[model samples]
Target: MKDLIKAINGHLAAEFQASHTYLAMSIWLRKKDLAGFSSYMLAKSNEERGHASRMIAYLVDSDETVELPT
Candidate 1:
């Protein structure tokens, strides 16, 4: 259970980073006047959020403790 929790948290951390990356890309694309590219990056960010949420739900179902460290 502990390992599973750790894995989930790791994935969550990665997703968090990816979100930041995509967000930055979107802003950059906007400044470049590429609305389509910006939208694409935003979509990718949403997908990462979904992936992390699934892992989190699985960990919770397994009765593992999930913590977000600041």
Candidate 2:
């Protein structure tokens, strides 16, 4: 269970990183006047954030500690 928790935390961190990346891409797209692509990337960023939130909730429900990435 400890290892599993650790793995989930790692995945959560990855999700957050992915979210950040997508958000950055969205900003770049918007600056380039690509509204459609920017919106898509923004949606993807929200999805990744949602995934991370779900993971955090799962850990909380399981009575496990969630360690945020540095």
User: Which candidate should be chosen as best, given TM-score against the real structure?
Assistant: 2
Q: Estimate each model's TM-score.
A: 0.85, 0.96
lDDT by residue (tens digit), candidate 2, 1-70: 8899999999988999999999999999999999999999999999999999999999999999999987
Candidate 1 Cα misplacement greater than 4 A, ranges: none
Clash counts for the predictions, in order: 0, 0
Worst-scoring 10-residue span by lDDT in model 1: 61-70
Local distance difference test, each candidate: 0.82, 0.96
In angstroms, how far off is 16's CA in candidate 2?
0.4
lDDT of 1 by residue, 1-70 (tens): 5776787787788887887789899889989999999999989888887887887787778788766534
